[model samples]
Target: MRKPLQHIWALPVLAAGLAVPATAPAQSIDVTLVNGHPSIFLWVKHLTETFIPAVNTALEGTDYAINWSEAYGGSLAAVGGELEAVEVGLAEVAAIPTVFMPTQLPLQNVSYNTPFGPSDPRLVMESVAMLHDTVPGVEESWHEYDAEYLGGGFALDNYVLMTNFPVTSIEDLEGRRIAAPGPAVNWLEGTGAVGVSGNLTTYYNDIQTGVFDGVIVFPTAAAPARLHEVAPYVTITDFGAQYAGTLVANRTWFADQPEAVQNALRDAAAAYTEAYLVEQTDRVAAAMATIASDDDHLHVLAPEERTRWASALPDIAGVWAENANGMGLPGSEVLTAYIDALKAAGADLGRDWSQR
Candidate 1:
């Protein structure tokens, strides 16, 4: 088993008011951690490196500490199984990518279709926080599923393409298999490209074994997976950097935690949010450098080709909203509010799906 990533030799003491109540003697608080993706994804790395260390630091003086067992590589929960895992108490804490469960977590799917908007991690995070705060009873969706969202957000660099062959125009992608998760596939519909179902773990082998021609994933993911070796063509789409993953714990497990442990978890969430963004932002530049000089064919998709993509995709917004509505989540309102917020933040409404 590989050790998780961590930074910081020491952490600052918390303010008096922020401290959790230390109650009872000889009580130990344990949290079982589950990650959906393999340990290779940047998001998982963030959980291990930045998030867990911060949680450990915050819980140093407390009787509560994470047992910190990783159920990675699908040993515990398979891909797209995280939400159910947490709900059933298979894991006390889990990082569930909402895009993976669009049918189950409709409320969380707001960010996936609200794309071509913000690529900045900071902006995405703030927007998500605002949605949780402003949207009516958005937090209750978790409870309905028997889970309590502790805290979760993704800080991803801009998304790009890693292909086995060079693609400078939209025509190059015609009929080519591009591995993408849920709503991401909707972006390719009507474009003559076939979207395959695959995650980061399956990507490397898929590319190497010719299972896919390329993958529509973030640069942060491409680098660590070493996809550059097999798929040499790197296209910078900058279409959007998705921010959708969130942490949820079994409500029963969370309620059983001592106040000190709860506080430690909260502090860890804050630290993870800050550090995750910083590392992800930095990875963009680092990945570019590595790709450019390292025998990878990097191509910046031209403006016209991007326009073709923006034009060819179906009206995913309305479809998504309707899907959520079917699931009894606040689909329509969440969609409208999220779009309005993005527009207020100065996002250009490139493709008018409202009319469609």
Candidate 2:
């Protein structure tokens, strides 16, 4: 009886409350992440494990979310095709292996051009990250390709030579067709080894079919690829780990995003770098152990021979820097800053690339 008295006015308020939508769920932004290589690669693996997860975590409780569509391993683009893919907006983001796109992203290959400086993955990563932050040319190079450089600066473990036969001296590499990825072919100059341009995906089949005599590759990758099965003789060349690639987003797509989304992408990239380094460190030791257990497969080149091999090489770094500078890029500054960073980190450099 009490409720029935003068309760007709309250019905409208109750109806209004019912009509209001329960705060609509956050709007989801769809982002496609493309990488030419399969997720088996450490860098690609962490895209799911660390980077994407970190971004999702950072955006939690926010009014924005990302629906990630991952296209990797030749699904969206073939190896070396990521640059063009992102440039044309085929994908929103990409893990671009700059080594593969040397012509377009020359500055990102500074570490590749300046090898034998440091074998520590962490140091290489930090130096490259620093270069990206401090060097305008580095960032500008990416912009030229219509992409914004995200923060994933990756370094592989130290490179080694996996050959069908043993390599005890520089003479052993004479006339040998050794496979090297992209610009790393430069590392073979004057070593008497013929460096064929090849990548991890094709090396195993190439070596097996006699396309090349051996491959200049790192342990973590070689182990999983099972290159040891075909190229059983492993020589620890100490060519040093290298910063090979980074995350990039389509410039237009990135510009259209909210500031929070932009920050989340960058923060996630940093997390990717750290996660990759940790995995690479642990995996390198484990891979070495796995190889060491098979004594017949693993051999460390004598330190003297390593130095001799390094000395036999031409001034590849100098030539590389000079060539880049000729093209109006700050190649020397990048080289100097990189070597300086390595030296500051107490790296036992095999050659003074900056001095040349």
* Highest-TM-score candidate: 2
Candidate 1 — number of clashing residue pairs? Answer: 1
Candidate 2 deviation (Cα RMSD): 2.3
Q: What RMSD value applies to candidate 1?
A: 11.3
Clashes of each: 1, 0
Reference-based lDDT, residue 62, model 2: 81
How do the residues 171-264 of candidate 1 rate in per-residue lDDT, one tens digit apiece? 8889899998777777777877898877787888998888899888877777777888888788877667676687777888888888877777
- Least lDDT summed over 10 consecutive residues: which range in candidate 2? 288-297
Predicted candidate 2 versus true structure: per-residue lDDT over 1-356, tens digit per residue? 45774588889888999998588688899999999888888888998899899999989888899999999999999999999999999999999998887777777888787767678988888888899889878788888779999887678889988899988778888999999988999888888889899998899899999999999899888878888888889888788988888899999999999888999999999989888998888899888765445777677878887777778778887888888899889888999999999989999788888886
Model 1 compared with the native: what TM-score? 0.86
What lDDT does the true structure give each of the candidates?
0.75, 0.86
- In model 2, state the lDDT of residue 220: 89
In model 1, the clashing pairs are: 5-49
Over 4 Å off, model 1:
1-26, 62-66, 294-296, 352-356
Q: Note each model's CA RMSD in angstroms.
A: 11.3, 2.3
lDDT of model number 2? 0.86
Best model per lDDT: 2
